[model samples]
Target chain A: MPLIDEILDLAGYRREDLYVCLGCKICSSICVLNEIGIEANPRNFIINLIMEKEELRRDPLLKYCTGCYACTFFCPWEIKVPDMVRAARAALLPSHPFEQAFSSSLELFGRVYEPYLLFRLLPYFFRKGYLRLLVKGLPSFRLSLPKRVKTEGIFDREKK
Target chain B: MRYAYYPGCSLKGSAKGLDEGVKKVFSALGDELVEIPDWNCCGAFEFGEKERILALSQANIRKGREVSSEIIAPCPACLKNLREAADSSVSVLHPLEVFSEASFWDRLPMKRDLGGRPFTPYYGCILLRPREFALRVRDPMEEIITRLGGKVVSSQVKAQCCGGNLFFKELEVSERLAKKVWEGASGDIVTFCPLCHLVLKTFSEKGRRVFYLTDLILYVMGEREFL
Candidate 1:
């Protein structure tokens, strides 16, 4: 049991951290996404996670997070919204191709890479009316090389 | 003061000005910055596994440890990632602390007139948040700006996220958020983190220039053209 707790603790976003959520919704209201018209109801999501609702794991609204910890900063319980999002995102990654592609770029190049990000998200970028961005990034190979900083896997332990 | 420098991937590329600005500012302050030999990427992927990011950051910490006991990460994302992996053995610092240091105050020449309105100081999303990992220098940019004969332009989006993580993933939505940040800001937007700088600098229209807090330090020290 002690070892399991350590593994969970080390693996990030411990279950014990979720137990402190008081459902105050301070995180929800203070969320910067709300200002942008995205209803990032982080409180409900955390509550759903605590309740073990499988449906919340598939919620598309979860993808709207900017990874901004404004909610965590304002949360009374100190529950990290970004960590909770990360936990949810781990399960949600397969369904979210854009996110999955971006993470794959990180695994490959290790930066918030531009070229591959453009290549992978071409259709999405076109649909999003950002072809201008793709065309601009098209000419910039000089910028892409710096994104590939190899992070050698020193800590090889993997969570079961 | 001397520390190991981790010019995270963003600072190496799009935010290169910040990297140069930090070096110049530190040199001006008489602090020595040594780049960590073979420092790996401090993970900035929002959807990346927490363990993976921590492991990646830990690798950089090990590299940083080879250089100095204290590590300086100029970008807020890098600062957060490195500090998350760093234990009591190594201290991670951001450039904001330099503003609070007595050395900065003592060495600063008389306030140079940049001839401007109140500069809209942007701290971005995480530069001073999540409490435990944030830099201690609160409102330091405002003080520095005021001391340098500039006013602090108060805006609702001053500390908001500049659509940083979304800029890459959700482009239109990122633009909407960036639009809010640019609109909410006054004349020129002054930012602390590289992502905020990247998002704002590239997205801002009408020639509304974006300056990293370090760039402002360089400007006050008299290098007019940084773009």
Candidate 2:
């Protein structure tokens, strides 16, 4: 399979989008991770991806690249660094379980069931002993998902 | 005064207070907020991959079209995605924009003062970036904030990314970004976007208070039954 095709499969961004990215370091200067402490520069990463340097793409520090799009705000070329990084992250993953969940949930009900997801994902994190995540997400677990779609009827209207 | 309200997933779940408060505010002003029947999620956050996100957004638009010509979405992320795929056939609006309308304000029964706590309105990146030239971003939050009788503080991070999109993927980075916003816009803050509210609240330190715009609206209306 071609490299761009692989990216499309993994991240869903188009290959043409990547070609538009200039080798500018503006994204690097504004990147939150790089400013905070992480060393994975946005410009360098795109260059590596464009050069098809697969080894550099797999560097563990690349995981810190968040899709905040602050870099997008400054880029003269308007390159979507986050999308590229998200795609690269997807490419690194053996299987994107959460992405699979998002796609399946959207497919089944046309919305993501976040609480149900928490219920399902809790045990895995528990076994992995991510106690902090459990603490933070527990409150969210009580929240309810929206009712499923009801077809063959008029819209649900509320009367005051 | 009647609009097809798209509550998105967050409104139904984590941000239920926003849904209720926004609905109540609309109702109080004699406008009806109708739910977009069988509406799906607005893909929560962007998928970054074009076709998949577009397909999901298109699905939402089709569903929204079935209900009403004017669709009002309270969540910024949802509004952004829905607007991306929404054609000229239907109009898209944020609740703040709807409330800011001169007609709506003229009908408001009473303005409840918030005891003058300073607030900064945060419009996270997606609602204004990328296609910002076309969208013509508006600042209705400040309008509503003042009408409800609150002081507005200038914020350096008004247009900055809150890192809500990265919350699930890179939490450390997300927290850092949220902290970055709070550092710039101190005091009790109110945000127009649910994702920003959630992210800011999750990462906020002890001194900061983050609220959904609807929460402030409801509080001002003296309907104190919010969670």
Candidate 3:
């Protein structure tokens, strides 16, 4: 429960947001569960949370969320179901190995390379052809970097 | 009119055409986009996750507040994130929506050479799902396309996701998704999101051209004398 509070604190969302949610099942029905083949019944999870069902919070169903946000799109009430599930999973990360690994990788990728490569050098590399040639020569170094990184000027800015 | 502009990571990088076109189109309509200073990475991928909202969205908002006006975002993901972060408190409008509102659509000069081709309005995932904004773009886009002697084909796949997010994580899924959108349509895809342009262009096996909405605008603007 303390972990739940921590998640809530981090999310800055109130329980009232969840309470406003009506279990209409729109989210589950529209979900791409058939493609992913994972149980992502957002309505059921919300209901369980409302009932204080601690076991539901511990269920493996939370792992299936791709954060695609199909649920939030269809919600008539605009209830933030994905946010709720993310918070719940955040609280249980200690026991959730898969989630822990994923989070760790994300944080690690963001830290080690994103600052220098993505935020800084990538832009310079795109602008200066020599830098791109240099990086290309070092294939191993480039291959080791995160896939999401982008070079600045990949998008053209307005001319001054 | 002037507003704070958050072009997002993609606009600064791979989607330069979008940034250039939007600025040109809006400037022609007497609108100004003041880029926010000292902006940080938008946590582009993680904002939707509850754990990252405060760090991601709030940080953008705090920077946005420095501008003292509603933020006009060129990227749909950035707009969506900022909208979610502001709790809809501030008006987070797409540059196209702004241009359309300023009656820029009415002032659009006709196209000279359409090549008799139709362009599908590719809404991408974020922009299309938000029905209000999608509808807003449709009318203006239609008017512009029609004037260019080009047809605007309405396709279901137009609003589909371009697999931009999945591309890096799952190449197979990305290729399949891109093919779905490409194969599902009959003509070239026109998009507002740069990620969609890059993804569609990469996966297009038939050499289908994906035009950004801004690119089309610039093209039309270039041909204004013909109109």
Who wins the TM-score comparison?
Answer: 1
* Shift of residue B207 alpha carbon in model 2, Å: 4.3
Candidate 2 chain A lowest-lDDT run of ten: A151-160
lDDT tens per residue, model 1, B108-191: 654465565678988887787778888777788887787777778865677777777877667767878888888888889888
- lDDT ranking, high to low: 1, 2, 3
DockQ (model 1, Cα): 0.40
Clashing pairs in 3: A123-A152, A154-B13, A154-B14, A155-B13, A155-B14, A155-B15, A155-B16, A156-B16
- Candidate 2 per-residue lDDT, tens place, B7-62, comes to 88777776776778788888988888888777776665435455555566676677
Task: State the lDDT of candidate 3 residue by residue for B1-227, as single tens digits.
Answer: 77788877566645666777777777777777887664544555443244454355566676777785688887876776676667454666777676556466575554455756788877766765444433345555555566566787866666565566654334455566677788777678887776677677777665567777766667666722321
Q: Each model's TM-score?
A: 0.86, 0.83, 0.69
User: Which has the greatest DockQ?
Assistant: 1
Q: How good is model 3 by TM-score?
A: 0.69
C-alpha RMSD by candidate, in order: 3.9, 5.5, 8.7
lDDT score for residue B25 of model 3: 79
Residue-pair clashes per candidate, as listed? Answer: 0, 1, 8
DockQ of 2: 0.31
Candidate 2 segments whose C-alpha is farther than 4 A from its true place: A8-22, A59-62, A127-146, A150-160, B46-48, B133-135, B225-227
